[model samples]
Structure formats: C-alpha cells, structure tokens
Target: MSLFQVQGLVKRFGGLLATDHVDLSVAHGEIHALIGPNGAGKTTLVHQISGLLAPDAGRVLLDGDDITALPMHRRVAKGLSRCFQVTRIFPAQTVRDNLLLAVQAHSGSSFRFLQPRSQAHGLYEAADRLAERVGLQGCMDGIAGALPHGAQRTLDVALALACAPKLLLLDEPMAGMGPEESQQMVQLIDSLRQDMAVLLIEHDMEAVFRLADRISVLVYGRVLTAGTPHEIRSNAEVQAVYLGTETLEATP
Candidate 1:
C-alpha cells in the first residue's frame, strides 16, 4: 500500500478550477516528483496535501488514515511535514537557537520555572543532531540570515526534519540555487528517501530525473500522466505539452 495518497482531489476558486480530481500516491521510501508549467496548479495541489488549504472534494490520506479535514499542525503531528519554496528561518538568531526553537516546539514541554533552555541536555543534543544532519554543524553559532542561500535552504529542511515526518512535502527546493547548490540539495533529498517518503515539487528537470522514482505531470490543475523518468522523457505528449521539443532533443 502507498504511504501517502491523494484521492480524487478537487479544488475551485470561483470560476477557476485550481485542482481537478487529482490522484497521486507515494509508496514507502519512494521519491515522487510533481512537475508542471507555471500556473499548472502544482502549488494549489501541494497546499491541499500539506493542509495549508482544504480540498473541495476527495481525501488526503497518510498511511490509509484520512487527513483531509486535519489542520496543518495536526497533520504534522500525524507525521506529515512540509518545506516551503521560500526558506523560513529566524533571521537574526543563530542557527543553533533556531533549531532549538523548532525542537522545543515539538518536544511537548515548556521550560520549567524560568529554567534556561540551554540547561536542557536533550534539546541541545537533538539540536546538534539536526545540525549535523543538514551539514550545518559548523555554523551553529552563526546567524541564520547570514548563511549562503543553499545553507539557508538546508536549514529549512532541517527544521522540517524536527517533525520526524513519515511523508515530507518539499516545494521547489532547488529554486534560486545555482548548479552547485542545486546539486547539493539533490544529494540531500536523495539521501532522505532512506528514512521517509518524499513528495517533491521542483522545476529542475535534471535533478528531478536523477532523483525521482516516479514522476507526475500536471497541467491546468489536472494530472496529465505519471510514469518513470525514462517514460516521461520519451513520451511525445509530455514532450509537446510540458517538457518542450528542444528540452529533450539531446537526451536519449
């Protein structure tokens, strides 16, 4: 059975059909990539799956449990987490402080009797692990906003990891990244499938083809087709509508 399922999801905004009976699934440890042209409703579909917006019809299920009506935080509590397109971090704070806050938020206990959070051994250790996990161990004391763009994005991913989710929703993680940064993120995302299934939305075709176990194409809020990378790369319909003729002309 699939670890996460979006069944017949539909959403509407007045006359615009933003999402149209979309069905998608990610199996255990699978990296499923969602791709589409601009205004194709990829963002709308992601919002519904991440609980930022509710679907007008159909269900969002995690491990076969209906989460369609759940709020965002509740969905996170139930092992679904999301990283936004823009990196979200505490700008002025040290990376360590930012991580501590995220760890504390999900740790389920307030500080006791004006006690310093730094005195909490477990939080510090957990925060350290998160830093190492995202390759931020050396920058723990550095200001979050001062980090390079790719590092900031990596830190954002670390924040989502604090939730220990079963399925992670990554929205355009490679956006704004140059080739090197994009490659680093591609490596990081590729490693994550060992621990959790990932629903990735990205426009970087090379990275998508390199990492995705399966790819889904969307157009005007509806899924056009889904298949392996080779199938997508070779499909004449996808080539004409989304990938473009020249984009894959050089590819075998």
Candidate 2:
C-alpha cells in the first residue's frame, strides 16, 4: 500500500473550488512530484495535506491511518512532516541552536536546567547529526539568517527530518536557488528517498524530472495526469499546458 494517500480531496473558498476531487498517493520511499502552472490548486492541495486547511471532503491517509481531520502538529506526530515554501528556521539563532530546538521538540526531551545530562547529550548529538546530514556541519556556529538562501532551505529540511517522518512534504525547495544550489538541493532530496517518501510540489521542471520516481500534473484543482518522467515529457498535452518550448534539462 502507498505510505500516503489523498483520496478524492475537495476544498472550496466560498465561491471558488480551490481543490477539486484531487486524488494522489506516495508509496514508501518514493519521490512523487506534483507540478502545474500558477493557480493550479497545488498549494491549496498541499495546505490541506499539511493540515493548514481542512478539506471540505475526502480523506487523507498516512500509513493506513485517517488524518484528514488531524491538525498540523498531530499529523507531524503521526510521521508526516512538511517543509514550507518559505524557509521556516530560527534566523537569529546559530545553526546548532536551531537544530537543537527541532530535535528537542520531537525527541521528547527538554533542555531544562534539571534535565538529565545523558538525555541532553543525546539531543546535542542528534543536532550535530542533522547538521551533517544536510551539509551544514561547518556552519553550526553561524547565525541561521546570515547563511545563504540554499543553506537556510537545507536547515528547514533538516528540521522536518527531526520528526523521523514516514513521509516528507517539500514545497518548492529549490525556489530562488541558483544552478549550483538547485543541483545541491536535488541531490539532497534524492538521497532522502532511502529513508522516507517525499511529496514534492515544485515549479522547477528539470528538478522534477530528475528526482521524481513518478510525476503527477495538476491543473485547475485536479490531476491532469500521472506518469514517469519519459511519459510526462512525451505527453503532448503536458507539453502544451506547462513545459511549452522550455527545455527540461537541469539548469547549468
């Protein structure tokens, strides 16, 4: 069974049908990419999946449990975690401090003055591992906000990883990144497939083609098609509506 499933999801904003019976799924350890033009309801679908907005209808299932009605935090606790389009990190704190906070939250250990020394050591160790995992080990002492845009995004991803999620939801992780940074993010995301499934919503078609095990195209709040990279590239309809004449090669 798929690790995550969105079954016939429907959402509305007054007179507007923001999400229209959208059905999507991510299998265990698969990289599933969602793509579309602006106003395609991709963000609206993501919002409902992440519990930022409850769906007007349909069910969201994570590892066989129904989670459509669960709040964001509850979903996170249930092994579903999200990294927003905007980097969500503690800018004023050092990288280590930021990771420590995330690790503390999910590790069930507090950083209290009276907390056990061994537990505190474990938290610090976990924080260091996270920084290394995201290639931020060298910047542990640096203020998060002072880091480059790509590094901040990497940190945001690491925060989500702290939850040890069964499924990871990444929203435009490569947005605003230069070629080198985008490549780096792609590699990072690729590596994550061994540990968890990813539901990626991105505008970067090149990255989508590279990283996605399967791609689902969304249009006007509904799924237009889902297929492998080659099939998506070959589909005349997808080419017309989204890719146009733009080459689907990694930016160099």
Candidate 3:
C-alpha cells in the first residue's frame, strides 16, 4: 500500500494553473521522482505537498491521515519533512549545534523533568548520530556556513531527517553541486529508500534515473507519464518532448 498520496492536487496563480489536478503516490521504501522541463510547475506541486503553500483544491494524505490544510510545522509533525534547493542552516553554528537544534525541535517531551546537564547528553548523542548518518561526523565542529557546498547540502538532508519523517521530500537536492558532489548525493539519497519513501523533484536526469524506483514526467502542470526508470527511459512520447533538449540516456 502507498504510504503517501496526493489526490486531484490543484494550484493556481492568477489565470495560470501551476498544478492541474495532479495525483501522485509513494509507497514505503520507494523513491518516486518528479521530473520535467522549466516552467512545468514542479516546484509549485512540491510547495503544496510540503505545506509551504495551500492548494486551490486537493487533499494530501499521509499514512491515511489528511494533511492538505495543515500549516508547515503541523505537517512536519505529521511525518512530512522537506529538504529545499537551498541550504537552510544557521550560518554561525557548528554542525553539532545545528543538528542538536533540529533534534530538539522534533523531540518528544520526556526530557522536561531531567536535570539540565543530563538533557545535554541526550541531545549531544542524538546530534552525533544525525551527523554520522550523513557522514558529517568528521566536520561536526566546523562552521555551518564554512562547510563545502556538498557538505552543506548533506547537512540540509540531515536537518530534514531530524524530523523522523515517514515521507521525505527532496527538492533539487543536487542543484548546485559539481559532478563528484552529485554522485555522492545520489548515493546518499539511494540509502534513504531503505528507511522511508522519498518524493524527489529534481532536474538532474542522471540522478533521477539512478535513484528513482518510479518516475513521473510532468509537462505544463500535468503528469505526462509515470513508470519505472526503464519504462520512462524508453517511452517514445517522452523522448519526442525532450528531443530538442538533452536526451534521457543516463544509466543508473
């Protein structure tokens, strides 16, 4: 069964329909990718899914619970986490401090009664674990803004993971990375499917083909096709659309 579902999702900006009755589903342990050309409204669809924007008409269900109308924070609490195109971190804070803040924000209330010093240990342990999960342990003491671009992006994913989400939304995770960094990100994102389903909106065809279990091609605010990587790669209509642009010939 699908763990996340978006039904008849519609979003409008003036007379232009940014998202047109779009429907998408992601199963547990699946990496579903959303891809399209510029101006295809991919980002708008993501905004609605992540609760960053309210849809004109649609319902978002996570684990069978409706979250379409909830605000961003409420949706996050409901196991919807997003990693944005830009790195969202405290520039002056160390990696450990940044992870600690995120962990504390999503943590339960059990530490309320504990002594201050004892609480510190628990937070530190959680922070360390998060860092290690994304291979940021070596740079735990590095300044957040000072980390290399790839590491900053890795840290961004770590921050999203801090929420313990069931469905993780990755928005152009490899947007500004070099070839090497992109490769590392692909591997990191690949690892995430072992834990939770991912709804990835990315422009990098290579990464999408490499990591996606299911791929949905969007055009003009609508899903043109949805299928496995091999199916999408071999679709004639898809090729026709991208014929003037780059070919989707990358191997996973």
Clashing pairs in 3: none
Please identify model 1 stretches exceeding 4 Å from their true place: 111-119, 249-252
- Per-candidate local distance difference test: 0.93, 0.92, 0.89
Tens-place lDDT per residue, model 2, 147-213, is 9999999999999999999999999999999989999999999999999999999988889888999
Q: Across residues 97-208, which tens digit of lDDT does each residue of candidate 1 receive?
A: 8898899888975745367656788988999999998789999999999999999999999999999999999999999999899989999999999899999999888888
Ranking by TM-score: 1, 2, 3
Runs of candidate 3 with Cα error greater than 4 angstroms are 108-117, 243-246
Write down the RMSD of all candidates, one decimal each.
1.6, 1.7, 2.2
* Candidate no. 2 TM-score: 0.96
lDDT of 3: 0.89
Look at candidate 3 and tell me the lDDT of residue 187. 90
Considering lDDT, where higher is better, how would the candidates rank from best to worst?
Answer: 1, 2, 3
